[model samples]
Target: MEMEKAREALMVEEEASELVSRLDVRPHRAGRDASFYEGFALRGIRVDHIQPGLLTCSFKVPPRLTDSSGNLSPGAIANLVDEVGSAALHADGHHMKVSVDMSISYMSTAKVEDELEIISRVLGHKGGYSGTYVLLSNKTTGQIVAEGRHSLFGKLKSKI
Candidate 1:
């Protein structure tokens, strides 16, 4: 029975991974001449790719983003996840998406200096409601650090 449960869990995770790949929308770094990311300090966060319903960003676990527990702070992880998810939506072009709601679950702790990868994928989109899933993992160990879901509302913005 345990084996069966484990297999099921693996299958679910695989499906989720596949879903993310299908969304394949690349991050938009060219529009702002890269200065925008620097201004926001998001220049340190490297975007791996963006798919239609998914996006991936990587970050180095710097001291400033860690907590006294010697692990990455929940708030920091949450914010990064939110940013990646929102970036996925805006990556197609240039627009603004506000997160209406976000819920994060910390599965494990990631220490400073750890390389972390965040994969954010859209779960669904209809009307004005859009749902996304974010998976945070320690790149070195491939262990899941956290996961989250976010709902967002988007509005077009004037070009700068």
Candidate 2:
């Protein structure tokens, strides 16, 4: 019994080491370098259209972003809402703002390999503050996957 317990403890420690190694994200190497989490969540996203105050994109639910059950993870959903919603404000000009608040409602799930449509629209803007609405839906079934309201604030400067 003692030998078996020791073997189990060794296996658990090894598993933990492996998991930590996999989770170590590389630090940004340059000014334009995106953090690992950002790149991981945004990878393979394709912009379908963009105009002032409006942005639309298509994305396939990548397996890496999925949860244990193979459905798109909730954290990934929030990242999509935040990034895509921010772009709606940036579309009018290249103004980048810091997200002050975010509210998301997860209405449904998208599994790995499922196609999702993401749309964002600017609600309006005040001096140094703005709000955006983002809707993510299933591309083929037309089911709403999530809805998000993102609020941001910052000094607006035109930067390419």
Candidate 3:
């Protein structure tokens, strides 16, 4: 059931367009069944561009994504790393990818309502493993809030 839900949530272009149309008519609320990226979008993450092995994303930090002290949560940052990194690979021709290992290093903190710019790239791929990197920075100040590295296993769409 969970696998079915996940498969449904990872919509293709046409299904994604339909989902957007529905969202225009009503708010999206998938509750506990939403895919990770779906939940991230609900929290305001927006992808701006994709090219080859790179992607650019941004989001205005909402209060809902902050911790009790009113700073962006590490978990939220990590989530961005996972999604954006996979997106980079997808842009680079991978049809499916799963994280094998991810490491994040937080350098600073972002406050609620901060607009963050995230840049993610695929370092390279060898065999089934790919190395990816992500950097999150304050859009206005250019201060890096966090950086993350991810190792993933995936197959090219053609190969798949």
Best-to-worst order by TM-score is 2, 3, 1
Residue pairs with backbone atoms closer than 3 Å in model 1 (clashes)? 23-51, 23-52, 23-53, 24-50, 24-51, 24-52, 25-50, 25-51, 25-52, 26-50
CA-lDDT, candidates in order: 0.78, 0.91, 0.87
> Model 3: residues >4 Å from true position, as ranges?
1-37, 40-42, 155-160
Give Cα distance to truth, residue 121, candidate 3, Å: 0.7
TM-score per candidate, chains pooled = 0.68, 0.82, 0.73
Model 3 earns a TM-score of 0.73
Model 1 over residues 1-160: C-alpha lDDT tens digits?
9999989877757776896677535456676554533444454788888767778888888776677788988888878878888877766443567789999989999998899898888787766667788899999999999999988876444555
Q: Pairs clashing in candidate 3? A: none
Ranked by lDDT, the better of candidates 2 and 3 is: 2
Q: Where does the lowest 10-residue lDDT sum fall in candidate 2?
A: 8-17
TM-score of predicted model 2? 0.82
